[model samples]
Target: MSVFAVEYVYAADTEEGRDTHRAAHREWLKGFVNEGRLLASGPYADGSGALLLFTAGSEAALLEELKQDPFNMQNFVSGLRVTEWKPVTGAFADYA
Candidate 1:
């Protein structure tokens, strides 16, 4: 599997929508964590976006998985940036 970093940018004036769906979003992520697909995930302190680390067979597979998120389905995401990541140090060095 390859490691990937995904950034989720929230749409302006969508905090209420995000809050309403937050629980379902988290619940969806929990399944990935249980399957060892998600390494870490959380929102930025400023609340502009969130970052998620994942392991998947390919970038396409990762994108497909991300499409399942409630946030994406609800159109709460204004923008998304996805990139393959190579972790060469710290706790993730082993994966490298």
Candidate 2:
């Protein structure tokens, strides 16, 4: 599997929708966490977006999985970016 950095850009005026779906979103993420696919995830301090770290077989596979996210399904995300990363050191160095 490869490590991927997934970026989620929140759409403006969607705070209420995001709040309503937060539980479902976290539940969906828990499934991945249990499977060891999701390493870490959280919203930005500024609340403009979120960052998620995951391990997947490929970018295609990761995107496919992300398509099911409640945030995506609810259209709370204005943009999504997925980047394959090479973690050369620190907590994720082993992934490299």
Candidate 3:
């Protein structure tokens, strides 16, 4: 399996827009974490964006998972960036 960093940059306008879909969004994220696809996730203090760490078998797999986010489906993100990362030594070193 591989490890990846998936960032969901929320649109400030979308944050307000997200109020319409917050419940579904939370439910979707909970499912992903339970499934081991999401290693970590949280919002920026400014409430304008969020970061998501993913541990997937491949980049394609990660994209497939991101497609499942309710917020993404609702176009609540300003942008989404996915990057491959190598964890050399740390609590997450075993991730890759």
lDDT at residue 36 of model 2 (Cα atoms): 86
User: What is the per-residue lDDT of model 1 for residues 2-53, given as tens digits with 9 covering 90 to 100?
Assistant: 8899999999999999999999999999999999888999999999999999
Identify the runs in model 2 with alpha carbons over 4 angstroms from their true place: none
Candidate 1 ranges with C-alpha deviation above 4 Å: none
Overall lDDT per candidate, in order of appearance: 0.92, 0.95, 0.81
Per-model TM-score, in order, reads: 0.96, 0.98, 0.85
TM-score of 1: 0.96
lDDT of 2: 0.95
| Index of the highest-lDDT prediction | 2
- Candidate of highest TM-score: 2
Clashes of 3: 0
Screening candidate 1 with a backbone cut-off below 3 angstroms (N, C-alpha, C), the clashing residue pairs are: none
For 29-76, candidate 3 gives per-residue lDDT tens digits of 888789876778888788877887778888987788788788988888
lDDT rank order = 2, 1, 3
How many residue pairs of model 1 clash at the backbone?
0
Off by over 4 Å in 3: none
